[model samples]
Target chain A: MSNFDVIAMALKNLFKRKLRTFLTILGVIIGTASIVVMISLGLALNKNFDSQISQISDITLIHVVGVDQISSQSQGSKNKIKMDDSAVYNFKQIENVESVSPIINLSYAIKAISGKYSATLNLVGIDAQFLETLGYELESGRFLNDDDKLNIVCGGQVPYSFAKNTKRRFYFYDPNQQEKAPDIDVMKDRITISVDMDYGNIDTTGEKSTTSTAKAHPVKFVGVLKYDDFSYSPSDYNCYMTIEQVKKLKAEKQKFDKSSANNNSGFYSDNNSDGYNEIDIKCKDINSVKDIAEKVKDMGYNAYYAGEYLESMRSTAANMQALLGAIGAVSLFVAAIGIANTMVMSVYERTREIGIMKVIGASIYDIKKLFLVESSTIGFLGGIIGALFSLLISYLLNTTNISFFNNDSYIYMSSAAQKPLVSLVPLWLCIAAVVFSGLVGLLSGYFPARRATKLSALTAIKSE
Target chain B: MKNIIELSAIKKIYKMGSEKIVALNNINLNFEQNKIYCILGTSGSGKSTLLNLIAGLEKPSAGQILFKNMHIENFNEEQLAEFRKKYIGFVFQSYNLFPTMTALENVSLPLVFSRVPKKIRIKRAREMLKNVGLENRINHKPSQMSGGQQQRVSIARAFVNNPQVIFADEPTGNLDTKTTFEMMDLITGIARKNNQTLIIVTHDLEISDYADTIIHIRDGVVDEIKNKE
Candidate 1:
């Protein structure tokens, strides 16, 4: 028979028992929707984890805290590789290494003083040229130039860190974003950084030591930084200075503290020429982070980045997805049995009709094809509607606060992040669901259709 | 006239557990082209088995059946379907119309199997229905028609493909005398009009009156062969 004839007859037969057909199709619809939504949930979890990780740490940036001297291949070979100038040179030679910048803080001894207002913060000293690669967003003015001697770029929340007399701590409270305008007009005021912790302290005892207070240099407030939320931003409460500027301040402070023999306040007489304790290295991409970080570890350094954590998180999400997909597969399997049952019953009811057609000249192939087409049509319809239905379910899931699991477990570092979307559907998954359901229909109908083709024409026609 | 179908030394045996019941034995028959023929016998006389054997519904134990010199018994299931699609038609005792299909759709079934295009098949089915006096019942389903009308639709279905032979098995068994006479007249008139071979299996002597040749069988064997032409 012609294709049109077969298809038309199939559709007619299905409509003959509309309620049964609808129930079978409903089973398939539920099956397909469950599968798609379950997979989408797993995918969205991974996406959420990625965004959370990106907030706390740059996946492409690796921080080398210390050299692993004991674990090094050449343990006692030559000079030790530390997180210093020599290590920076060695790190640059590694392929895919974009840039390297050392991070140094003058031991919280530096205080920013603007008349009566002063703030004690971690006064970091970085190479002025490396500021561009450091991903700092300035709210006003410009970045420190290469020739800048004392130009300082204050952090986004530096103003809130300032207290009136440097005695009482200023604990600012902004739950989501702990950043706001400075209490003092830092941009316009004449500020100086002093190594003496008592630079702006109210001397309650009125006791004058033999040595005068350490010299405080005048500082230009070059710029203020934008308050991008601290959940992902790095060092939003610290201020920056050129490396030379911090060295000059700290060396002078060491000389004064050493001369005062009575003041053995744990100040180091050595110039720390060994190297800075921490170095930040940026890579070209997240994919290269693990490889270069591994090479640095082999060279005896504790190189760390988010890629390792991300890989583990991705695998966990994949495992969870497979589990969820298996759950959904059970639904489809049940629906397949429903289709098979319906088709078998249809074959039984149509035995006499099949015989009549055989006598009228229908081939066995035609008989089998007719039944398969009917069942597959049910499956295809169910799958298509199910895909669409899952989208609706996904929208409801994301919009409504349906927390399948707390993101606190999935987030890499930050605990204060907003909840991640719970469901995500890719285009291919929807298409696969439909095609797979149709294939399931064909497979389920196979036996019933075979039985139909095997019905004896003489006996079948003789039946009432 | 040339013979269209030939059956020689045909035998049909039905197995009842360990017992073998010989339904038809040592039967020989020939049907001519474009002639009305009948196989007449009483109930359980093996006439139906003989008809079934000739129709290729059941294989013979030791015989050869040929149609137009092509051995019908040798053809496999697929080739038999091909043969039937091109040459054979069937009308049943109960009409056997597809309950859901309209009268026109039922009539066009054979043509649909023959791979005739829809428009042309519908046209041929309409013409055949018109010949059977069912032109007004084109869209009526079998449940909506009387037994006579349903039989008329069945006759149209059998003849729609313009097949060379039509088989009517107890076509009047379910009809009243008036309706049965009308159905026979309509069926035979169309068969003769197309110059096609007709094979009717029935026990009624009156129903066999229209046939050009009648074969009488009793107790699994042909007892008489009469030619009225």
Candidate 2:
């Protein structure tokens, strides 16, 4: 008989016992839904970990620090790998390296001031041309260009960087606007930058006394970055300037008066030439972080990235998925048994019909295909319904009222762009669930279909 | 007329716990094309067993049943099924139709196994049902039909495929006397019109009166052969 005829007959047979077929399909639905939902929870956990890691550090960035900074670990290693212009150039030559910029962090020796307001400064000096590639987002103004001389990009916290205004605080998502707004507008105002630590001392300035003076230069305002609770970009809470401008500021400080500038800036430890103290390397993608970091470590510089944490977190999620999936498979196993039992009962009930078909020239292959098609159709229906049901359940569980996965790491994704997830059913998981249930049906129906094919036409005809 | 089926020295034995009961022994027969043959025997006289053997439903222990120069007894189950599909049709004593299928579906079943397209097979089955005077009961299932009407549906099914050979094992076994005569006439008439071989196994002498040849069997062996034409 033709396959089309066999399928038509199989569907008719399934339709003959609607209640039994429905019950069998219900078992498979529960099985598939349980598996899909379980894996979705594990996927949510993976997403949560990724969100948390992204808050503290970019997974693709490798921070290269000079050996002098790692004095605790490498006491005598003469490895001359400095975090300088040469090291930055060599890192850019590495495969998969997207961009490299040398950086220097100065927290104490730098100060910025408006007419009557003094601001405490954490200044970061880097290549001005690489500002855009470094993932800095602007709140008001533009990034520093290559032609900028004394321009500086202020941090997102520039409003609260007052020197002694200890009572004032800044909240990123402040709702009650009753708190006194800062009088300083960094983006529109010009600021004077001084390399002297004692530039703003009132007592020494009141008497014009013996503190060696360095003139503060007027720096132009460029960009002010927007705050991102989930990002660790370099310009988040610091001012960015070109490395050449900061170096020139230091030179001017020394030329004006050698005493205060030569005092204790900690910009150097006397064991090295003039080079940058830090280099930030941006990789093309997350997968290249570990390899590039390892190569930098071989060059005797300290390389740090969050790729190791990402690996452990991902493996943990995968293990959870396996455990949960196996637990759900037990129910599916029971459903398979239900399918087998239903098919076996159908075989016995239709023994006489099978005999009629055989004597009427229907082949044994046709008989087998008929039963198999019936069971698989049940599975296909159950699988599709079950996968969709899993999505609904996941959404309900992840809702704010349930808050099933409300945890520390998930707080950032609750923003408008994305929601915090407790359960996540991806597309491929649904496809896998459907295909797996069909295979289960095919397997369960195998023996019963075999028994149907082995039925003797004469005896079966005589049976009833 | 030419012999379409030849059976020689056929033997069928049943084993019941080390006891061998011989159902048929030394049976030799030839069925000619375009002729009706009747094998008459009392109950338990191996008439039905002979019909089953010649129909390729049962294999004999020692025999050569030849059809178109091929040994039917030596053919495997699959080959026998293929051979049956190509050349054989059956009208059972109980009118074994699928209880769920309608009269038209029952008649078209043979054509379905022959892989005839749906449109052509339905058309052929409808025509065959019309010939058996079941044109109005085409949609009625076997359970909804009377014994005579069900038997007519079975006859239509047998002739729908137009096979080379038709076997009827007590075709009217459950019918009244008038219905039995009518079923026999309808089946024999279709077989003769198609120039096909018809073999009927029954004990009723009245039913054998419609046959072209009659063979009487006693015990496992043939007692006499008589040609009425």
Candidate 1's C-alpha runs over 4 A off are A69-81, A105-110, A115-120, A159-173, A176-181, A194-217, A229-231, A244-275, A284-287, A409-419
lDDT (Cα, 0-100) at A282 in candidate 1: 91
Worst lDDT run of 10 residues, candidate 2 chain A, spans: A165-174
Candidate 2 regions with alpha-carbon error over 4 angstroms: A36-60, A65-132, A142-151, A160-183, A190-220, A226-234, A241-278, A283-288, A299-302, A327-333, A387-407, A413-417, A421-440, B203-206, B216-219, B223-229
lDDT of 2 by residue, A1-464 (tens): 78888788888888889999999999999999998998899898888777767766667888887753565245454544556777888899899999998876664356666765666566777888677786667888898887889888877766556544221222243333225655777766667877665455455235421364767788887888887644434455677888888777656645544554446443332233366767888999988889999888777777788777778978988898899989889989999999999999999999988887787787787788888999898888889999999989988888854554456445543444456678999999999999999989888999999999898777787888
lDDT (Cα, tens digit) per residue for candidate 1, span B1-229: 8999999998888899999999888988999999999989999999888877778777888788988999888888788778888898999998899999999999999888888999998999899899888889999999999988999999988888888999999999999998888888888998998899999999999999989999999989999999995
Chain A accuracy of model 2 expressed as TM-score: 0.75
lDDT for B162 in candidate 1 is 84
**Predicted complexes: DockQ each:** 0.73, 0.48
lDDT of 1 by residue, A1-464 (tens): 99898999999999999999999999999999999999999989888777767765677889887767577546765665666788889888999999987866665557667877777756777878677676777889888887888888877777666656646433354553344455687788888776665566665675422244577788887888776653546557667888777777767767666675535322333344557747888999878888999998878898788877788989998999999999999999999999999999999999999999989999988999999999999899999999999999998998887878445554423443455678998899899999999999999999999999988778889988
- Candidate achieving the largest lDDT: 1
Backbone clashes in model 1, listed as residue pairs: A55-A232, A68-A300
Fnat for the candidates in order: 0.68, 0.40
* C-alpha local distance difference test of each model: 0.83, 0.81
